[model samples]
Target chain A: MSYHSVVMVKQVPDTANISGQVMKPDGTVNRSKLPTVFNPEDKVALELALQLRDRYGGTVRVVTMGPLKASDLLRDCLYMGADEAFLISDRRFAGADTLATSYVLAAALRKLQPFDIVFAGRQAIDGDTAQVGPQTAEKLGLPQITYAEGILDAAGPKIRIRRKIDQGFEVLEGTLPLLVTVVKDAAAPRPCRAKRVMAFKNARTLLELEKMAEANSLLYVDQLKEEYVSKGLFIETMTADDLDVDLARCGLAGSPTKVHKIDSVILGANEHETIPANKEGMYALIDKLMDDHIFG
Target chain B: MNEKKQQVWVFVEQRDGQPADVSLELLSKGRKLAENLRGELKAVLIGHDVGDLAKELFRYGASEVLLADHPSLRHYNTLPYSRIVSELVDQHQPRIVLFGASFVGRDLAPRVASHTQSGLTADCTDLQIADVTYLRKDYAELLLQIRPAFGGNIIATIICPDSPVQMATVREGVMEKIPLAEPVAGHIAPIPYTPEDCDELVRIIERHREENKVDLKAAPIIVSGGYGMGNFQNFQILYDLAHLIGGEVAGTRAAVDAGFIDHNRQVGQTGVTVRPKLYIACGISGAIQHRAGMQDANKIIAINSDPDAPIFGICHYRIVGDVMEVIPMLIDAYKHKLK
Candidate 1:
């Protein structure tokens, strides 16, 4: 059984640590000041997809749509036994929210030909929306298994999965060509094999070679790209024109949602009237809570 | 003919005759939403003969309760509960459906939402009715559901623009339970939900209650430890202080990662969010994720070796001392006072 799977990965700023310097006067993150890494959960999703490929003989291809620098996570994916990688980088692919993100990912995925399954982390830790997986499923018109903790078994077109619910787990079977979003507890991601890491270390996208050419007059962009492709280090670069994405819906122009404001709220405790457990005291406490909109 | 008003519905979550506190909190919130919309507050209680619990919901401001009581619904089998909820939702459409952000709600809501083709938001921290003027009357058009995003650095307001009925799972204790004001007036409508009409795909082997029951969500006072506690043995001081203060012992994800406590006891973005009356952080350098979970607590006191610990940023009081030493003195002081 040959299993072909594609895992969507993203590089997001570490939103967990916000200091005074996080936002500049323009209210945007000073990207250079913050650490960017492959979303922790998406890496887990990639590991799950790769493991499925490893169990059965198949190819695992990783596809990510972001800036040129976003190729970092793609190379990381290659080092983890991904057979192929594609980076959809272009100036037109900036400021994409979940809705636009799903469109871009689905478009990029279409160019990769076809696959048996698509896996994404339930949600990116940075956004924590849990919307992309379902949105992508909607875009691709596929049955989705969201919050999948474990894939129990896979036989041909049918797959048995255990989805994590709030209380316990739900066992469900679905057909092939489905989108599954895995949770953190799905499986621990394996560290990159030393040999594979070394082999793919010099893998560079075409944009990187162009940058090297601009920096040093002695370097040749075509030769470096050729060498990297031989080593399987080059992430197959794609653009809006390559995916045939409608210019209107490909980036910020396609996204209708707007962030009205980003404000940090410091939650403070309200005035409280403490009382004893007696009936009369409790009544006063309740009245105060109701008055303060804390209770009704 | 009067326009049909949509009713506010609450999913009465229970297990082994024990009602989750989140159910009461949802009811407490449901009462307000119903009042603002000029609708009735209703509870869809599903379980085996939980009719006796109807009065309990009414005490928390349920105007009319709908009980889908049956033997098959006794234990929480998702197939039956999902079917019952889906059936009721189809029959009598609710404007808003609130569920406890517990394991059961997380499972049942998504299945029912998918079944009904409705929108559902999980683990919402804040909920408000957005009023808009239409046809010379003010109509509530959206439920502005808010939840911590970016690991608690910001709150994202989500609206289900197309869905007729709005739904959100409320985190436990995010809202306070309302006290019964002179025994509320309400009626019980027992909707018979039978096993014959349901499909059972799951088998229950054996249900075991966890012995070490430290329900940090319901605890009023919690003394929390973090990575700064150094080792597992040093965490005992946190336990001693919490025990002395008549509170529960909790830990940050760091402590959980350090193997000082189980994952269930972790308090952070990936763990439980607690809003205790008094929260004492022992040696915990608060990260944004950790703060998101416990920042809702009433009075926070920090005891960390470093004065610049981020925990002090949100703490009501800061004790710039080591938890290994400070906690013992506080424990001894309380003991001496008790004596």
Candidate 2:
């Protein structure tokens, strides 16, 4: 039996490749200056989902909740073989923590119902919270397995996952319609297939179509959207209004957690020694440490 | 202060019938927090036949133990653990909840938070209770969940201003674990196992646990490498020096990510927090996140080719040169001295 998998992906600031201009004077990041990459772990999650889809003879639908710019991430997902993609973006959905995020995601997933599995990265590097996937599972009323390393077996409605733990691994069996949060080492994501890129390169969400229409006066938003839809170049777009969610729980209002304060930590310099890298300096340093009984 | 004492609970995490050190650490920190709020510190120990762990929790400042002992609850299955914790919080309406940021805790906590509709934060470096005003709202005894954000470029203080229960997960060794000189007078209140048929839907078939032999936290001397160590072959020099000096080899998050070192030996905010007696930095340009784990070392010696590396500022000795040159010389010097 084929399974229907919905993989959640995110576009995060490439924290690993920080440039001098990316850091502001206040020590907080100028996030706009930092280049964005498809979050590494999320891409791995997508890869695992794609692999499952390949083996089980099914479709992989990818979803993301971010700014309109996140359509680029969805395009990358399409290039990697996701059969469908959905972007849930709205001004009201800003400043959402994991709980609020899960609210919107679960609503969007409900809108596209009857999916058997929801796959997500173990944690996003931007937040490093790892809460969104499990929270989404809770809201969806599905069992979740986090830190999933690899799928050992999947037959009929049952799937067994080998998940990573503290310095170890465990094999767990869960039924279909469950959530699995994949870790980074789970799989190396396949490169974008050249044929898929040439085909889906023109994929545009409704928001993107509206932008294009605005840029070209000759083009109307409705006509452009219809043309893209007929060409199968449309990325399904859902806004806050489209979701059947309580407004209060959609954005910052629904979020229980708030940022109290931020501190640009500047560590006070302490007294230190300057030792050369030469033989004499190395010997002296090791001797001093030995004298202090720090090393044998 | 509210006349009714606040309820502060720590989820006492156990694996294979042994309590996790981070749980005890939270109990220690929870005691201080409960005191500040004029509250009670309770340890929610949920595992099969783990009633014996309650006394240990009491020793680490838990005044009450809510025991959920059952055969099914022995291993950390998400369904029942989240249900029991969520139901307990719902029944008592606790003010604060703490969990170790371990795999099991991270897996179970969000589900519990979503179920109870409580505010949750992960990997908090510091937790404090404070009275504050925010956005024209006055909050009393809010849990100031402090964590380094944006790749440790800034530290953000987070709070759940609206929710009654503020939950946070702290990585192990972030907080100090100080057990009381004398155990507190606490009693175990057994929480009965209420079955949900859905709980059996997810089953743990087997576990492969590697008894982690790399105790970086307990090591006296740590020869730590970073991404700047150049290559995987360069990382071998660190083990050479570590062996010569009776020390352990560790790596920064970057080195670990670059596949130069294993993650268990990683030292950083996301990795193990180590405060060894001596930490030798090898070609490491330390980020604030990396420093958070090793900055507390009694004495640090940074060896980097770039003189401007951030690690140089915190280290006791700054060796401005290649780690390749410095490490082998140190190893050779040690071998000669021994001879």
Candidate 3:
């Protein structure tokens, strides 16, 4: 029997880059100015799912609850060998904290049923809260294993995994219908296959296809979608309307937490000692540090 | 009908009978927060044969210890640990629940919060109790979960206004673990552990906690690298300088992500905090996350190619040049001058 696994991913700002985001004078971040990338750990989670599919003879489907443009990320997943992809996006889902995001994800998962395993990154760099995976599992009433390093065996209903903890590692065995949150060190994600990239680059959601049809009057959205589906390039998309969701629990309105204040990192004034890079200046600075007993 | 209780819980995370340092630190912080809310600080201690740990928790200011002792609960299996904690929170509602941002706590806290429908904030740098007025609703004694967001560009103060129990996972070393002068008498509250079939679904096979050979936290001097170090091979220059000064080597998150250094040697908000006597930054452009970990160093010397690098802002000494050029020069000069 073939197994099926769903991997949850996210598009996050490139927070690992030091210059990714800038702080405004009002103690807020100018997030629009930053560049966005697929979260690093989520990519690894996708890779693990792909490996499981390859070894155990199954399929890997990726899902992300993000903006409509997150179809770009889903396309990336296709290029990396995902069997199928789904994008869950809606304006009503904005301002969601982890709890709201998990609620929406669990709803989408329920819609896409018959999955044996679920995978997710340990945390996204944007919020770094790392709550959505376990929260989603809780919402779905499934068992979970976090900080997974590698899968030892998954040929049957029971799976063994090597997971990480504080300054250590543990080997764990659990049954199917489990949620596994992956760390970046779990696996080196394979690069996109060139042929797959060329094939899936034109993949678009229904909204994007409609926009395409609008830009070209000769093409009808339905005809365009029919042709795209014939070519296996139509991406399955879901908005808030399509899912069984309590509107109050899907977005910021459903969020229980609120941001009270934001602040820039404050540093006290320092008496900086500027030194030249030349030999004489470098030697003199070394002597000064030595005199102050800063260097032994 | 639930009424808000004046009780704060600090989960005592233990492995093989030794309590985690961050758990004690949270107990200390919880002591003060409990006082501010006019409540008792309860430490939920879960383990086998760790009953005597209650005194240690009390010495760190736990007014009461909730003990859940069972042989199956000896090791921290997420299924059983989270199940017990979530059941207790449902039975006895807590005002605030604090956990360390360690692997186990990060894994367990979210599950409990979700099962109990509690609001949780992660990686908080500071936690305090305050009266909040949010959206025209007055919240008395709300837990202010302060943490950096958006990759450390901004520090946000988050509050759970709707959830009955507010939860947060605080970074280690951020709070002081102050023991009470006169230790409070330890009060034990037993939590029954009825074995459930669902709890046995996950079992631990093998576990290993390695001892750290390089203790960066205790280093007198550190030679830290950043993404600007360029490549893995170039990290040799950093090691050269560190060994010359008899110091340890570390890096920012950028460097660690770039594969320039090991994650264990990372210094920043998400990583271990360090306050060496002298921090010599090489090719490091300091982000707020990196600054939070090392801003307490007695003296900082930064060398970077970019004159506007943020590391220069808090550094005591700034050398605006290529680290590849300056670090070698400093290593050369140290041998000649200090020797």
Candidate 1 structure lDDT: 0.74
> Which tens-of-lDDT digit does each residue in B1-339 have in candidate 2?
367789899998998889988898899999999999888999999999877787788788788899998888888899899989999999999999999999988998899999988999999888999998999989888999999888888889999999989999998888888999999999889999977899988999998887789998889889999999999998998888888778899999899989999988988888888888899999888888888888889999899999888888898989899777778888877877665
Please provide, for model 2 over A1-296, each residue's C-alpha lDDT reduced to its tens digit, 9 standing for 90 to 100.
89899999999988888888998887678888989999998999999999998999888999999999999999999999999999999989999999999999999999888888999999888889999999999999999999999988899999999999887999999998899999989999999999999999999999889889999999999999889989989999999889899989978999999999989867678788899878898789868877878756
Residue-level lDDT tens digits of model 1 in A179-209? 7888778899999889988888777888888
**lDDT per residue (tens digit) for residues A1-296 in model 3:** 45699999999877665342355665466777767899989999999999988887889999998988899999999999998999999999999989999999999999989898999999998888889999999899898999999999865788999999888899988888899999999999999999999999999899999999889999899999999899989988988899999999878987878898877776556789899997887899888888878876
Model 1 Cα lDDT, one tens digit per residue, B158-194:
6655466777787666777876776578889888765
Task: Write down the worst ten-residue block by lDDT for model 1 chain B.
Answer: B197-206
The lDDT for every candidate, in the order shown, is 0.74, 0.90, 0.88
Candidates 1 onward: DockQ, in order = 0.12, 0.81, 0.69
**Clashing residue pairs found in predicted model 1:** A166-B103, A167-B103, A167-B104, A203-A233
What is candidate 2's fraction of native contacts?
A: 0.87
State the TM-score, rounded to 2 decimals, of chain A in model 1.
0.85
